[model samples]
Target: MTAIQLESASAQSKHEATLPELGLVCITVSQEVRFRTITRTRYLQFDQKERKKALKSIYEDNLQRLNSALTFCEKHSIKLYRMTSNLFPLCDIEDRIGENLLESMSADLAKIGERAAKLGIRMVLHPDQFVVLSSEKPQVVENSINILQTHARIMDMLGLPRSSWALMNIHGGKSGRGKELIEVISQLPENIKSRLTLENDENAYSTSELLEVCQNAGIPLVFDAHHHICHEKLDSYDDESVTEMFYAARETWDNPDYQLVHISNGKDAFKDRKHSDLITDMPSCYREAPWIEVEAKTKEEAIAHLRDWWEGET
Candidate 1:
């Protein structure tokens, strides 16, 4: 099989004449997002001193990292770029509670989206760790859906074209309660639902499981390599089993829209699910998947590691 899985011609023709480039998820530059220490807490609470420090400090950051990556892409002649944002908090009750961050975020997103468009790049927002549809608490699930609704509005206001520029990366919930998740999705506005895409989680579902859902929901899927490896449901001890899992994910999506995939590395022991630097070295799976975003631990090192793989001598 080819390194990357490909989609059908009909689906490929829907996107712009240009193809999507391999994307890197960024969380490093904004230390507050990745390093959940006192600094982040202070910043999140609107502590002036800490905010000033974070704003002024210019050490390995998301903004600088994005600039460096764009320059690297320019040097390498990469046509399109993809990025993952950790800015879902604006929709969270805690983050936006008694605050107007939602409006501010919407305004800022437009500018950011415009800039990304100018740079021939697209940004996607991946649901954070706490955002889950499988939560037993009805409130938590409601909050997650509320966040999705906010995301759809943000994308709409930012002039993002449907099926491009912005996408919601969701994981299939465990507990075999995906039917509840589907009901929530079904309740979304048609336009918003159009932008919804489901991805296979590490354990909750397999590629086949995700495909089955997509077949019924009429949506797409983003396959995560590391998640697939760490999946408790998938027996990864044997090489043949691994190969079978990979093939199953690859064959799950007959449509091009389902082609996008996430690539990352994890410990074979499945302890800390950190994104390792060995992503590019692994054989590519979501071939012809229009987009591939790296879910690394830190945004800065993520790009650094990706460049090492993309331009490095094999």
Candidate 2:
């Protein structure tokens, strides 16, 4: 299936036509979201048989809920979405039971992928913050690789392209380890490397820093505007400067048209790192980005609010 369908609307006609498709990350805030999980402690308590059963149950439930999530996105006309890293919770642990857990659910995963593709939804994934491939500790690096591999496997099972269009985005962990990061990325299996993307974090790597890493690693950079402002670099969030960064980030992508930009407003102030419930403004720079993932705390509701706000402004 095609990774993404480019929007026909021109950037200048953003208001006159539909605004760039906004993506909802992980869970939804407006309703009861079912992102089930199994703690390591709880898993340890169960017998071998029970552990396998529990893992299977949780994975199945998560897949069912994911189908529901896809349907919700289709109904709302949200063409972009970020799947939860916890979808298969605790399944990545070295001591976990059911080594073939994901394999068992291949049919379910294919169905979800087919549904998403049919609905014209562009799917992406962001593993939790702990996935640090550049860690000084060997075990940490191994564990991180395991986590990333699982994410890549999920994307493959869904039949998504092994490209940035079905990006598995993460931050450039442990700032200043750019060289080590590049080395680690170079060794990654094609499944993980081909679909991998680095994002600028609020405290660690600034846009400029990660941009260099992305360039070296031959991967696309997912620019997070909120993180840029909160970063120590403290550059002006003015339209001209942010737009310049946007364009620079765009060039890193194999296909600039599929570059993914993340958008979210600070909770209390422009510099606050905590995401607010809704986006108060759309950066003029966003016109240069085709797929903008709404990282607001309100999830899909934030996209709805942004749509309303955009319409009102126009």
Candidate 3:
């Protein structure tokens, strides 16, 4: 087997001396999976046999990609390995775990959690975009809460601690604003709260605004570099103002237990979310953060960039 080599991002700064774990967005792999799915569509597309075959192939291919990347990291002596929901969901292993559709994902996750423990890999699941906590027509927010609570139940069923291998990445909903955001989180059981993390988003609130809400509610805050920039500038704030907003949130939310964060290249023009190549230009402030996940347009490129950035080679 070829050893996957990873580039180190440590030379750039002392804070990065202990390189934060790195991961690809995996959503980029969507094209590969979708392409194969389309090809398999013509043959037994929805039939149980066909669905099983296609899903199996997708899982194998994705694991191949991850294993290859992990091999690369091993060869280079890199320490971080981050996998987001973007890649895992493509496997559609939801049916393997839990009870109904709501509980379906837990079994798959329990197996994944065990694997992560054995492999020393960190597994983080991004909240599905559709999951939300709002009193709107669709009631996505309530449904999302139910989904998470069920996930909590599933974890318990598997004998996993709430803080075990998996982590839930989430964003506050804009439907009900601040008060509603508090209500959504407050309703969750304490066990669920420990597993749930709130990330900063561009449209909903600035890091400062989110910190204010989470601080009072006792929910941990996640800072997305790009989302902070988009939010500040969307309302006409300049680059300097955006920078100020990001650091401000960092200062307010920084704590020992809630230390993990998301970092990605985002554009000022938010007409469509186009992952920016300027990730190399990440503000100097984030170099010291203990955990940062790199989300890019594609996994291959993200893997390469993170390696380069990690070693200060970029």
Candidate 4:
């Protein structure tokens, strides 16, 4: 090859080797809500045969898309990702597919996990807002447990060791009953609890409140910067608080060396809870955030914009 070609290849290798793993910007399965809803509405279909067929078809498609998403993350050097909540819509739909669902999805899931492992791509799973483990109602907690179990199953299928990288974040749940919240999380099966993390919710719980809950529950805290800003539960927070909390979260994990944080911007004129297309400004002392999950509307586009902004500021 020419001298120019050799130099270009060397430079590319050097860049990849030194790329700072500040935080892995992630993208969900699909940015478009309606488009990502690959699963068809099965309740309306009365025939069991048709419903089973639909279920299998949707799951197969979701898994294929999921594999593709993982590939995308690897290509972009995004070391962290949030799996589509509905990747496997029904917890037990695998029953219809004959042999155990985990067994069926094992090969595909393992393949994705292997790819992620090679690239050090951490997968984060967030159940829908409906998961309320600390709710006063027993049914809510029970159902939430079922969801948690499904997440745990996914972790097992991935064969990734029980670590923060395979985090399944849940809010502190109901507003009050702090003790119950701790107790509820404590009661979860060890497998489910192992990869579990408590994220600060905007309306439901404050960062400090959930931090305490996570401490009491013996789990790490996944601080949500946007939620913390919008949270009225606390009077105020400052730069020091951010650093303290960042470390506080770090201490809760076995691998404190790498902490995962969550971030998002408002969709409108100001910083509201709604996720915007991109974050114009970084959160206070964003450097403290070891690993961040950008929950912005535009997903990867938002990350790309933030990277450009971050580079300019630095």
Best by lDDT: 2
lDDT of 2: 0.81
* Candidate 3 residue spans exceeding 4 A from truth: 1-17, 27-111, 153-160, 234-258, 267-272
Worst 10 residues of 1 by lDDT: 1-10
Task: Give lDDT tens digits, candidate 1, residues 1-314.
Answer: 11021122323443753333556554334543331112345457755455444433422243345445555555544434443333333233343431243454455545545555555555466655556776778898877777677666666655565562356777777557767666666776765666677777766787667767766666666666566666644334234554455555555444445456776666354434765544544434444446667555554456566666555544
Q: Candidate 4 has what TM-score?
A: 0.83
Winner by lDDT between candidate 3 and candidate 2: 2
The 0-to-1 C-alpha lDDT of every candidate, in the order given, reads 0.54, 0.81, 0.54, 0.67
Residue 283 local lDDT, model 1? 36
* TM-score of each model, paired residue for residue: 0.66, 0.92, 0.66, 0.83
Backbone clash pairs for candidate 1 read 4-287, 5-286, 5-287, 5-288, 6-287, 28-299, 29-61, 29-62, 259-289
Over 4 Å off, model 2: 1-18, 232-236
Model 2 TM-score relative to the real fold = 0.92
lDDT value, residue 280 of candidate 4: 72
Q: Model 1: runs farther than 4 Å from truth?
A: 1-20, 28-108, 232-258, 267-272, 284-288, 297-314
lDDT of 3 by residue, 1-314 (tens): 10111011121322435655555443344343221233323533466665555566654455455555445545544334554343333232344411333244445544544443444444455667766664454466656776676556644543344542245767776633777777667877776876677777767666777777777677666677667766655532235655565555555443432256676665455423567543545655565555567666665466567667667743
Which digits, one per residue and each the tens of the lDDT, describe model 2 over residues 52-155? Answer: 88999888888888888888888898888899998887766666465588887788788888788777778899989889988888898888998898888888
- Report how far off residue 247 is in candidate 1 (Å): 6.7
Superposed Cα deviation of residue 68, candidate 3 (Å)? 8.3
